[model samples]
Target: MNTGAVVRLTEATGVGRAVVGGKAAVLAELSVAGFAVPAGFVVTGAAPDDPELGGWMAEEAARLGGPRFAVRSSAAAEDLPDASYAGLYETRLDVPADRLAAAVRECFAAADSPRVADYRRNRGGDAAAMAVLVQVMVDAVAAGVAFTAHPLTGDRRQTVVTATQGFGEALVSGQAIGEEWLSTGHRATLSRRGPARVLTARQAEEVADLARLVAERYDGPQDVEWAIDRDGRLWLLQARPMTALPPPVSWAVPGPGLWMRNFRLGEWLPEPGTPLFATWLLPLLEAGYLDGMQATVGVRVPFRWTLVNGWYYNAPPVPSAALLVRVLRDGRRRAVTILFHALVQVGRDPAAADRAVLSALDRQWREQELPRYRRLVTVAAAEDPAADPRRLAEIVDQLGRHAGIALWYLAIVGGSAWKMEACLTRFARRHLAEVLPDADGGAQILLRGLSGAAPAFDAHAVLSADWYHPVAAELPTITAVTQSGDDRQSALAVARTAAEQRCAAALADRPRRLAQFETLLRVTQRYTVIREQQARTFTLAWPVLRRCARRLGQHLAEIGAISAIDDVFFCTRPELDTTATTDHAALTSAVAERREQWERQRRIAAPLTLGHPPRLIGDVIERTVQRARPAGTTAEHGSEVIVGHPASAGQATGPVRIITDPRDFPTFAGGDVLVARATAPAWTPLFARAAAVVTDGGTLAAHASLVAREYGIPAVVGTGNATSRLHSGQRVTVNGTDGTVTVHP
Candidate 1:
């Protein structure tokens, strides 16, 4: 194989990976593709260990104008997608021109070291064929690795860049804890640890773009190594398909107090909130929450909504000495009573202590909160922004203020449904575990649909699908699976009947127990239906709000305040509200900047709880309210299994269709297991076609759960990493009965 003396960096682009090896081949290809690469050459013939090699190599180094060089082994088997034999071979950095041959020999020798031999054998490689690369060493100011996709969430839309001062080796070799940035093409979000930064925002974004471009050409995500010289010029060092990307690790709380995402705020707005939603609506929503708490709970609950990594997280007020004092001062015995229930309650069913307060809240929602919200939404929805363009700002302002408060009421009512569910599950599990199989299904029987009938929906009007998805969402087809009059709507319906019959027969001898069970079942059933209905009703003004913003956006675009109509989502309410006198140029730049930041934030997974994790007191309140813990909400899981709450029963095996955005709705095929972070009302149409359902965030009371059971498909919810762990077209067996998903190769 001694066909050449050496291959120059540019000329090596025409050489094969077999000759120049993986690292060298990629660098050469990068140079050919017009990417900035340091001047280099690869020594290609097999006799790298020849004793007299140093003299000629030093002469060649001098010819290339190098005072120092970086010599690394580029084995044919190195940097492979299946097995990146990284660090198994030697890399000699800062080799003086006179030491080129020694560095090359060292790299060549390391290729046959015991570790490399073992790696190649384990990964089923033929014997190593090594090429040694010597490149002009970069006088790096900062250098590091960049992943074209978010390694944590497997979100390809995000690029993760890490850097440290001086050499790339310090970061890659685990010698330095440096700066980290997440980029979404247009934005670079640096993790600030100290006062100084290795790369500026613009420089980090350039690094991200470099990685993204390489991935685009290669048609897959790339693990790119890069360096920035003292001159601030970026250079591509090496690139290869990423291998064994790690699962999520850090979910440290992003804020303070008791924070959570997959509950009140996360229930619908599961993904990171857009800039407009975060900046304008979320704060207003928080204010409304405070209002609703005052109305429903009789004292203002310390509540706030925060945007962490662009995801909406709610910080529920923690009960405290101060809160107790405030509640006593306000003369709201209702707040004190609930706090007493949370603090003093200890029983087989902790939620039982709060039943009275819970009932009061339900009534408040029905009589006071729901009506006010309904009235507000009606007025907001009635205003036609198109016909009255002048009133767009007014409509937008009113919606932002009222919509948040309206949804807060929805949460208040829906929260009762969640508690009733826990109470019902606890009662069933304790008393009827033998007869009922599981508390979830036992509870499901009494809670499946509105008591006697499913509420009819005009499917077309529901999603207003023409705007988001190419195909309009459809309604689930009705089916009967019974003999004569007991015709079951689904397998679940049959199971529900069987469970109900078992419960009835089991408690027949005890009239008191039967009566109690019946009462609990009725309330749980009623709230279950109402929760879904309220969720739908509260968002009625969304179309109005979005349309008004867009109308404002059209005018903004016409006046050159933003680049596109959709960019309106990136503008703050203040900017849009004062449009006539606003600095349009400044607004345009702010919108563009916000658009990038939102994109970057959206790619990273938001922590479920931000700040110190809840302690004993918080646990007690949560346990009483939510007894059945949401499963698999941690960082670790089996290689091929995803665990979550079994929202619906009946197993099915099918290909996955993960819908992160509503635009992906059209790609869903019938019988595919629909996966998502969470589903909103607009997402319900996908249920008509999904074979089974899975969600990264949601509970048994979520849209996916209710709709899947309605559609007679299996569903699992609250597997925190389902969307990241599974990809589209991957086959999976969803055991909704056991709440386990098995990924197939």
Candidate 2:
């Protein structure tokens, strides 16, 4: 345990947990159990002579031979009976012996990270002593992660093993590539096998046995990391308890054949009698109002993109098994942000609200009235003169276009840093799916056939003018109304008033908005029935539909189909098909010449269009909509409730940061307010340095909350956009009281 000294994993014992750490202990235990544990050494609690322990570890690694080795962290408390620090540490795979010391030091540094320190602190464990286990890297035929019980369901007597090609690190961190298995009993095995990274029956049995052995030896339910070496020998690397599951909630028993559904009605409903508004009047000059464009116009445009990119990575690798899992794990922050932004913006953006209403109505009609044909779906009585169905439909289309623009902006901005293709494809597909119905389940059919030898369907011919014709018809109307007003403020007012009137009128006859909501639900059911009936025939429709929509959008761009003539021209296809009389090159030259002339004209008109209030409004809306939402808590004060998330678990008074994006990160000083949407692993660095971590979305295990607990700081999560609710630099007391973030000035 001296400085620069190391211990082999084979020689270490469970008692070594004090000096060598848990990783080496596990390796020792596994070696004695006759597992194919690799040869490695442990750098005990002693700090090495080299300033950078990892650099020293790398030097020692060279002595052992330079090809491949695993430098893993072995904390005293990690992989114990409680709390598995699975992703909280570091491991370097395929490291050369020459770089072993450096890799080991890296793991040592990670073990002392704020997040890791916080993790240990929360568990009431010492964070001082850490052991590093360096094992000779195995040439694996397969690698995976296994659990004695269903980690997700807490179903014991079941073992889940997920295997993939490559090192065991991916499997341990849930980033494994390829086929997987969910096995039951000590002997039973379940696997899905195929030529493309599929699991065979024999391998399934072997994997199940491996899981069972780890569980049995661990003396309790355990999560195990393992690999099958090139010779088909299964090797157990590490094992620990699963701490992510929570106790099941108790609920009232329902009567036979009847089940009640619970919905967050409060979220959708406006606060009683017009919620309190805290308005900050900015300097008229600071507002920087564009000529002919109202200041409020930008505010009404939903800036959904900003929040969504909280999870956006720049330049992601190809979508492999490992990458997908990584995305899923890391992207949770983004997903939550997206959902929050959409919901919050719906309350703020008139255009978004209108679209949501239309979507609800369309869903209702499809699920209820269309299927039965005999029963007409209920409609609201309050019909505003301006809330025309045609107009609303057009508004929805315009909203979709703006949303697409936001995605485009994010993709291009981060194109150099992360993979933009997945983001683009995901956004495009999702937007398209929302508007298009699955007549024959065609979209799914097409996607499934993408990797197969499916026939080359004429997507434009099959999809256009038929399946999506109705939706397309609404787009023109959307375009027309979207640009009807000069600025965002006026356009929003127009859309909002129309929507309000319609909803109000619809509720008038029913005496309650709830009744109208019920009608909408019925319509949604009818629509689903109709779709079920149509699915049998339109199974191959989506590919064609998507192709047609893409082409149509492109065509629209060519013909200046939308108001932004310059933008449309920039997006157009280069060549247009012509009749027999035109020569190829000559015709191309003529078209190019005309395009240049049009470009010149458009440039002159650019400022005119840009100056229009609605166009300027679009720009501002994008900015606001993209901002991140921070957590907050609510405390009843007279007739008002102040809500904000408690960053530290306890109660303390402090000023809030009200951070809405990365741009605000620098403004935070130690112990200042750390308000934001949900925090991800990447955001943990800030958590250690922040006074408290308040977020708009999360539960106890949320990234910010977890770090806060480690640091013994007060943390409050799920404050429902505390950053927006509380003004920046507002002094408040955050009480992480009974899991609620109460804000008190």
Task: Say which candidate scores most in TM-score.
Answer: 1
Q: What does candidate 1's lDDT look like per residue over 387-486, in tens digits?
A: 4556876765666666566666566555456556667777877787777554244455655534433433322223321121211122232221111122
TM-score of each: 0.64, 0.36
Candidate 2, 543: how far from true, in Å? 31
RMSD of 2: 27.6
- Candidate 2 local lDDT, 1-745, one digit each (tens): 2244566565677356778887678778878878767767788767565455665565556655537887788888777666677789898888777677677778878976899878877878776578778888887877777777765445675676676676656546654334555565545333322113534556766777776776677766777777777787777777767666433222222221111110011111111101000011011111221110111112212111100101110111222577445544644554333333333433333234324432443344345423422121111112212344333323323322322222222111111111111122222233333321222111111111111111111211111111222222223222221111123223323543453344445446656543533343333222222222221122122222233334433443454443222222222222222212335445445445544443332111010001112322243222321221111323442201344333233555677776544334456666776776555332433444465666655533234543454344566665544543455565665655423444443
True-vs-predicted CA distance for residue 143, candidate 1, Å: 24
Best by lDDT: 1
Per-residue lDDT value at 276 in model 1? 68
